[model samples]
Target: MKNFTRVLLAALLVASFAATAQDEESPALSISGSVDAYYRVNLNGTNDERTGGTIAPGTSFANKTGFALGMANLIVGLDGEKTGFVADLAFGPRGTDAVFGSTTASSSIVNQLYAYWNVSDAVTLTVGNFNTFLGYEVISPTANFNYSTSYMFSYGPFSHSGLKADMAFGDFSVMLGVFNPTDLTDFNPTGRYLGGVQLGYGGVYLNFLFDDDFFQADLTAGWDLGESFYLGVNATTASDSFYGGALYLQNSFSDDFSLGLRGEYFSDQGVGAITFEENVIDLTLSANYSIGNLTIIPEIRTDIYSADEVIEDADGIDVSGDPINPTYGSNLSSFTIAAVYAF
Candidate 1:
């Protein structure tokens, strides 16, 4: 961990020196970032004493029912005339969780480290690791209207490492990419590659990805109703009977205050060790109050489950030394208060 930090500091020093030595004609470097913290209290009082059912489901930012640091994100970028790069770093729970296969806490700081080159006015190429383009929700809390995430975004790929081309034609644009296996950040485990395509026009976008016989598709659409209201929708489905959809609506009553709501539904097929039907419905209502660079978000979320699987429990019926808790009608609800400062 110390070595990694030293390398990062060295890279920053070199970049700073190079930027200082550049002439006025060189593109200026830009720095921007956001930091967020939040507190949450779950109505279910879920505990991890038994292991499977204690953790809050679907809520990523405020997974615990107390004050926590979401992330301290620092983004630096340089856009030259024909070549540029972006280096993003983060340190917190959100950052650690977004890294591919990052199960335990560590000192990895890189969230996105990618460079791009402009091939022409309409074509560009980018390489290295970047955030996944498959879902509407992102890892950044400042970018999302709701603090809690959806099932689709929570379970989907967080980032990809590979190369891709971005092409624009009139009002339509396309992105084609070849990526390493899902959730792989440091190295590629297999020789197989995942291919992705993003097609967009106006306020509507469609994405498709395929990997080793498994395919996923996503669609996102946005519309502005006059100047005060907006509507957005996201629907995604993957092979193996995994699918989810979310509807978002927001209304701005004032310049600094707005109300937003999201309704979602998700389902998972019995493909793993568990063999029971599973379905989830969640609803979240959130409010945003902006005060200059700082924004306050207060949200309420509820989740309902329709499942027949039995999870391991501590005091339930024992089977081979493992107790089972029937999870047929269990549900969860929580409230969060979060604040974000961006520059």
Candidate 2:
């Protein structure tokens, strides 16, 4: 009888410990990412790059002619109750273009690597390299409604390595950050730092970034007009350099199908601007069709420039087989079809 009682008590103690272990929250590790590819063609211009022909728009991604690979993104994350970390990586042409500012070989493959601490219910702090908060369109295709990027996004900062603090109060939020010089993700070599601040009310955000010699201000907002229709707006100006605005309208016809349009006006404040020497207007129409975790996007885009800046035709050889120059035009049009899968 004594031995039986002792055995039963020991078993109960062990069961209690097991239950306690199960009740405690343990950190979870997860994996998620996306892969994308596309086919593009110039409607009115030559598609061959061998002849020094510009394949597509001057945007960042999905610019390659014919069938081409976009990228494969792999993200790993560990989430805890009060802390978390994310490591994002990318491969292929689109990825390479996005991280062109990386100075080190090891950091070239990294898209975003950051850790966050939830100091309170309304405050959080993050450190390390992360995507820029100023742009409406992100570096990932899965997050953007259009596969082809915009001029504003192409010229804006892509990523920053820094520390940021986010705080929320009711319907208002604020973010402040200090980072290494724009896009210098590996290390700070210039010894100069960038300061950033963002204020948000409801769904509207006003952002500003400045350094010793550069400054940029931006506004981004979105609204749902109806159950099936949405509107998004973005405007940005860089001091003495460039300014642009874009409008996005989207309508969802069903759970699996939707259409969107983007219209933009971008201007270069000439003398020292990084873009073209003139102004440009871009219009893009795209449709999204989703099948499980895969989304297909077909897009039509046209770019109209204030001057004849687009390469319309380029033939390296003339009739007599001598080298000749390319022809320029005021407008360029293109079409693209892309497929993206997320997991």
lDDT of each: 0.76, 0.83
Q: If scored against the real structure, what TM-score would every candidate get? A: 0.82, 0.88
Native-structure RMSD, model 1 = 8.1
Clashing pairs in 1: none
Top candidate on TM-score is: 2
lDDT of 1 by residue, 1-343 (tens): 2343234334433433443343435689999999999988765534444334454665455677577789999999999877788998888888887884633344267888887777679987777778898888998888899988887888777888777778899889998777777767656767666777899999788998776577889998889977999999999988855788999999999999999999998887643311334778889999999999999999998877676322222344455644455343356677889999999
lDDT of 2 by residue, 96-127 (tens): 98899898888999999987776678977777
Model 1 worst lDDT run, 10 consecutive residues: 308-317
| Winning model by lDDT | 2
lDDT of 2 at 8: 37
Name the TM-score of candidate 2.
0.88
The C-alpha stretches of model 1 lying farther than 4 A from their native spots are: 1-25, 47-54, 102-107, 270-277, 308-329
Minimum summed lDDT over a 10-residue window in model 2 is located at: 15-24
